[model samples]
Target: MAQGEKGGRASRVRIWVGLFAVAGGALLVGDPAQRGETALELVGRWWPWTLLALAGLNLLRSAVPVGSLIGPLALGAVGVVGLVAVHGLQAHLVRDQLAPALLVATGAALVLSSDRMGLRTSWTRLLATGDVVVPPSVRCPVTLRAVLGELRADLGEVRGQVEVNVTAIAGHVRLTVPRASTVQVNAQGALLTRLPTRPSEFTRQPHSEGEFTIHVLGVCGAVSIARV
Candidate 1:
């Protein structure tokens, strides 16, 4: 059953890729005189919308978990901002005003986006290596950060609706969760992070009242969540 699901997902991904390639090919082969702009120019200005489309497509997929939509939603927001900056604003205005505003907005977004309600504890590793062991009874909404370092978190037991926010910059993070709890990983990074289609050992209602949820944000880094 898992194999069949995997195959179906792979096929769906291939279809999306093919469609994107065909669309790009059509643009490349079109007559630039009719459009008054070259294909490359159009692509440069419009590529961000593709990100928005991709995010929408992912959300439309049947297998995508609701908790996993956070990353895609953020991507879509980025796409919208990119489009506005590139297409709506003048170069001088973008550099002088929009850039600073963007930076401030990004910082604020990072702070506001994190799930901090009932935050149990926060851990940070900077230019060092560390590991965390979270007991089964631990509280929800824990935050972990790594900068130019490596970190591992072992979640022994997940009681109900446990939320973890992990961020890494030029670092690596590994999280291990118990097999008994349903696990969902919503991550954004250069590395591809796979969301669990189903719980392997213990089968329960997905997105039920209580499950393990991991939210990861990485820049030039890798984050992995494993069942054990």
Candidate 2:
């Protein structure tokens, strides 16, 4: 199972890399100068497409569950908002502020709808340190957000499938899980990440007993997962 997961991840990465390379090649071959346009002008017209591509990638990374729709939906909405501001309306103010406004609104909506969304625990820390431990009785999604601090989450007692979303900025995050869990990690942005590679530690585990799916976003931070 571990080998299959690795193969799938590698293939997805290859596909995305190939698509980006092709797009880059096309841009270089079709010089903006030849079209009587500056590089900025070209970017102004094509930036929405880049956002759409990212939305698609995020959707692919998401699990096949209802909770997974949130990220893609937000990204797609931002991309649509960008398109409208850049081309349909051509409002500089809207282009500059609308996407961020929408993102903030989405976050607020998530907080309001957490109960309906089956979020069991939500933790946010700014310039602080803390730990979150999930007991075996809880079987819902968990969210961890941190900025300029450290956080640790222990899921060693969780008995079944669990979903965790983590966001960190200039901080460190450590996750401890049962060794029998089949852990799947999807991450965005630059992060120093470490996970056990030894087959005996995780690869040999049966997927039916315990599972952990984690989505991570980090900026100039580190994340590590330990199996116990």
Candidate 3:
């Protein structure tokens, strides 16, 4: 297929995926009883919403190329609506459902836009010395020491060598890197690692070349690395 056609198909896929995410979120918040469940439980049950939101956001940001303010505003709106619907109403209503659904839908739309516009990775390195939640697709290296808090890495091309450390606390770490990147993950926590199904020549081992380094220090949670 032509590059444009392939791109179009990817765009459509993002849209449909976003729609499904919205629908799934609607189901979770549609029932107030779901709120009775613990936050962890709810998150576990509706984890897909979070993934959908991330993918949608990533995609949307790329497509529209909007200012930074708009992204935060949209995220805040989704959080508010999700929280209100899940906590405010005692009785279930379509409106309650709509809030979460829209949140997911908006996320989906954002994802579609982002993918089309080709904005996939952030150049900034985020360090959170507390409980940090990360996506499933991240690549982690095993060279740095451990610390207290959570660390997450959204994968991209690695131009150099990297080291990550996880300190003596329980937290989460996520890494996303290009397939050509080398990764070493050394952790005491029960790690949940995610990688692309297809094998690539990039991340087969540690590299001697020095390009970029990603390091994480934390206690416990979950660690995920998605190879680009």
> Which candidate has the highest TM-score of all?
2
Candidate 3 matches the true fold with a TM-score of: 0.28
Clashes of each: 0, 0, 43
**Of candidates 2 and 1, the better by TM-score:** 2
Q: What lDDT does model 2 reach?
A: 0.63
Ranking by TM-score: 2, 1, 3
Question: What C-alpha lDDT does candidate 3 achieve relative to the native structure?
Answer: 0.45
Q: After superposition, how far is residue 226 of candidate 2 from its true place, in Å?
A: 0.8
Q: What is the C-alpha lDDT profile of model 1 across 6-86, one tens digit per residue?
A: 465578669879998887667657564655466567569756764564334333432443345457556755865787767
**Clash-forming residue pairs, model 2:** none
Give residue 153's error in model 2 in angstroms. 0.9
Per-candidate local distance difference test: 0.60, 0.63, 0.45
Task: Write the residue-wise lDDT of candidate 2 on 72-136 in tens digits.
Answer: 76787878777885778666756565665456445533432332212236565555455567667
Model 3 C-alpha lDDT per residue in residues 1-228, reported as the tens digit of each score: 245545766797798899988866776685646653654586797788766655455445434443553666678667766776778844355355546765565544443333222322211122222112222332334322223223344435344555544332343444556665555543324334222232222345554332333333343444466666
Tell me the deviation in Å of residue 62 in model 2. Answer: 33
